[model samples]
Target: MPKVSKHLNAANLIDQVCKCLDEIPDHRPNHCPNGIPFPNFAKSAFAMMHQKYDSLLTFDSDRADPVILHNLATMYHVQDQKVPCDTRMREVLDPIEPAQFRKPFKKLFSLIQRNKLLKAFEYQCGDLKDWYLMPVDGTGLFYSGKCRCQECCVKNKGKPNEAYYHNLLGGCIVHPDQKVVMPFAPEAIVQQDGDNKNDCEQNAIKRYLAHVKREHPHLKLVILLDGLFADNPTIELIKSYGWHFIIVAKDGNHKSLIEAMDALCDQEQLSYHKIIDEEQGTRHWFRFANDVPLNASKLTQNVNVLDYVETDSEGKRHTWCWVTDIELTKDTVEAVMRGGRCRWHIENQTFNTLKNQGYSLEHNYGHGKQHLATNLAYLTFLAFMVDQIQEMASPEFKKALKERARGVRTYLWKVITRVFLSWMLEGWDELFDALIYGIKPGRVQINTS
Candidate 1:
């Protein structure tokens, strides 16, 4: 069978993740005793996400089952007999900063890199095979009026509780050719330092960029963002980190940028190129101008503008413009435009999958007084990161994922949901085997009481 690294099998990868959870410093008071191990709460929360359980109540309900307890021990390294209940999970996980979960994302990434699954995300840039296409975007997790927290971003200025919401800045390594996008740790967007000023996506991007850079200093990336991030400060911040960016520059949002492009076109400085297919009845047009000022105010800092238009077989023309620091040529414009357009994958593939698929990211799992909502979001993404890596690297997992009418990812989780809730797994392999080959993976214990 085709394979990834011997260690990339989910069993070992999960062990590493469990270890990372174990290292999350317990925030409970030093004098506290007889409480559940902090890692058990973390692992139990992760298990709930991994199994696509409906809520903390659903996962907590089965904590007493010997089968559920055994599966937690075998699969998630929860040695504690006590799994944290719904309220307990949130209360314990609340004060813990969301950044603590980032190690698991990095751990999974290192393993994926070692296993060479990340090469799929790399695209050729001149003689270098180093550029990983990463798209950064913000998304709404959920909103609540009555369930407000200190970290919730209030949308309206009138009533403090009128429109409380939670948003996250999510970024991931992506390629146009792949369905699976490798996610980095996401940044939560909320009120900062208990301030009344609502945090915006722009501020979150600053924190997101700084944190990702600190975590992965050597990794080369081409960051993609929407029109909101196509600004002087954000671009300058990206450059300070020695990274490249392709940010969408819309006509209304960046009128100065469009004016600059128009001037370049009038001066005949903009290079134009096109690729057409008679067989498919499609046309792709590209225009690029280098060293254009970002805006009237920021004349000193310049960016490259690439305009793209595509005419489909149905004769519908779609167009877009992007500002980037990557040196643009007619030859490189199409590649850069494709990468720029990948910002949508942050919406369609990543966020949409998390919401529509079994991940249940927007579900108000439990919003605590502090970081409960944010920490749960990280665990959901962490589970998603591990699941995506397995989907790509594990032959066994791939087989299980494609079984019967369950080829859809949402369906696989359904199988896992049933297994996790009902099946008495002897080991992790039995679950995989049962999903793939339909053997009796486990049996429910007979009622003797």
Candidate 2:
């Protein structure tokens, strides 16, 4: 483990991100074309994502201000004398493959690892320590009736009513107690060439798993998944990468496996159970069976099955079950349960925050003829990753967040944008101080240089 910094800040992280963006090769042709620099256009798009602007029109309007222009140039490394309009931004960015945008995400992850920020994310299960819990799931980002792009997957509901939508498979490093979840590069669930079959979450997961393994081959990850991924092939794929998994094993899907486990429990062979009483008159019961085959066919591939239920005085019961490659024992059952439950953070913290909490992730920014919608989603997730990093480590960001009365992220974003436009601030620290200490910007010396 590296020595973690106590003062890691977002400004420096953004600056490093800009440097990484600078390294992406400009694939545009050199002939007579629009004069807007690719880096400037890319930076402008990234700025809109970071600010959580709902549309490109608003971002273009804000970019017209000379103060905002100066701030963009100074803060985000946009070099063009003029910001690219929305149309030109789409034109320039659409053709640039979404895979290129993934570089910055990898860069940010590397930075987090180097700074030892991942130490706080390390999850343990008895003898297992320092395992990063990566939860993978899929969600719909865009849906329209009339608008259908080449990338949109078509869903026909028997008649004239058809739906075209874009779905993505997203994974993030998550922890049960941690409020922030760091997202990885998402894989789009879109139509592919020469294939009549529509792309689904399972296919996307295969691609995403390959991508993750190719990108970070050495990182120790325990794959957390929902019931959809509790199958033989997916488990084999995970095992092939030398990774561990804790996947939801629902009764409806794994009936045979459940029956076999129940038989073992009835015989009290390879089965264990524990009961605990809480102060609030709640009784918690845990049961687990080891070396259970996943199905009738894959009898050689065994998994450890674990389940828990809590019954209150009112007779209400809450139950959960999971299957994992990890060995099931009395000492490790609770830790495994915690790891399994942390999968919700990917949906609640990452997806829900992006959708409802001011990121406007579901809003249609632009559906270009090519990869615009997917690229915009990628950029939005990148912005969310930066914010999560700041929340986890930066004291200045935490202080500014505390100063807000409502404590809503959207309001905080509005406050930051207001301060950026109204005040002659030079860096993030000065802007944060203005928000935190209520210091008038007029009193501070403005450093335009």
Candidate 3:
């Protein structure tokens, strides 16, 4: 099998995705002579996601233009295409399984690994070295009192009213210092059967973890998780996969574990370390105990408990506590604390950017009876992954982003879309050149011949 190219740019990445979509078998009725090919419909939908169009109606309107049609053919590789109307596009995409979209994510990650882009993400601490930190969390994508499909999870609020919502368990590779996060495939927390039981985050997490391990069995992962995942079963699952973890442990939830650590500290059996940075007017205190039991029932499941408190010149203080399989030492405790705290990036960088920064993750694009909403979310995340890759690797994109005023991403997107629509460009390099250096190609003309 041929490897994905080491020198892939945004255009080449999209082209590779087009090839992957072309391979997904279209299950539309065979007798329908007018059915759009799945790849063309998928590519068009991805274009909307790539450009951050708010609605299918707006995307369909833009797709009606001859210039847009030509661009779709040349740039995205849509084939034999009359632009499908919004309704038709939804109908076509509804039945397609969302899992199929994960292929491109895996492929792109492989390319990054092969090209040595992942080296920058390797985290180093005390005795631990060269492990990638993957933070996992869940978020609500859609919520309503009225709209819902079969997949929506319903919550009855002890009244005549019910809240229907869609939730997704998202995980991302992160670093303590880097702002960019590379999201992995997300698992939908929804109704699996017609049963009364609604799916949940913990259940979704088990599925997500299994999927991640199955997909990348050999990748050295140090899983970072929140207080919700500090339970015995989840920790056991992480251990069973031969992966390391640093999970938030709160006194309220893990009282027994906290008490055990406190007892060890009173006996002076645990290690204590402190640092005061006079220049920054901050004091750091760390305490750690090894061979600590996680809970009453799981005494055999030993873990390392580490906690830190930081005090500033104003006398305000902040504290964090975590449980990890990795041993805590004087040299390694601070790095472990940083890794544990960086788990919030899954929310701040990945979910927030998707929801607030013009990706319109919560907007109701299409809610088909089957998989349309989930599929669209997957495609949108794929677009985000591409943008993140460019942010890390593309100097031209970096230059354009730096020159963008006020650092408003939506405005930058507008400029890029306008350039894409107005000019005839060969690839992403030309697009970035135009944005960075004010170079313009001749306006694209509709070929009437």
TM-score of each: 0.94, 0.91, 0.91
RMSD for all candidates, in order, please.
Answer: 2.4, 3.6, 3.6
Tell me the spans in candidate 1 whose CA falls farther than 4 Å from its real position: 1-3, 30-34, 193-199, 298-300, 440-446
Q: How many residue pairs clash in each candidate?
A: 0, 0, 0
For candidate 1, write residues 84-182 as lDDT tens digits. 778878889899988898999999888887777877788665543678888999889988767888889876657654788888989999988888889
The pairs that clash in candidate 1 are none
Query: What is candidate 3's CA lDDT for residue 27?
Result: 78
Candidate with top lDDT is: 1
Which segments of model 3 are wrong by more than 4 Å?
A: 1-6, 31-35, 157-159, 193-199, 298-300, 403-410, 424-426, 439-449
Model 3 C-alpha lDDT per residue in residues 1-449, reported as the tens digit of each score:
11223254677677777787887778787736665666787888888888888899888788867667777777778777566789988988888988888898898888677777777888998766778999998888888888788788887844579877788889989998888887897888887622333227777788899999999998888999988778778889999998999999998889989889878878889889999989999999998988899888834588999989999988899999999998888888888988998999999999999998869888888998898889899888888888777667655566678885345556777898887776666667777777877864467566799
lDDT of 2 by residue, 253-295 (tens): 8988889888997887855556566667777678888888888
What's the true lDDT of residue 379 in model 2?
84
TM-score of 2: 0.91
lDDT of candidate 3 at residue 221, scale 0 to 100: 89
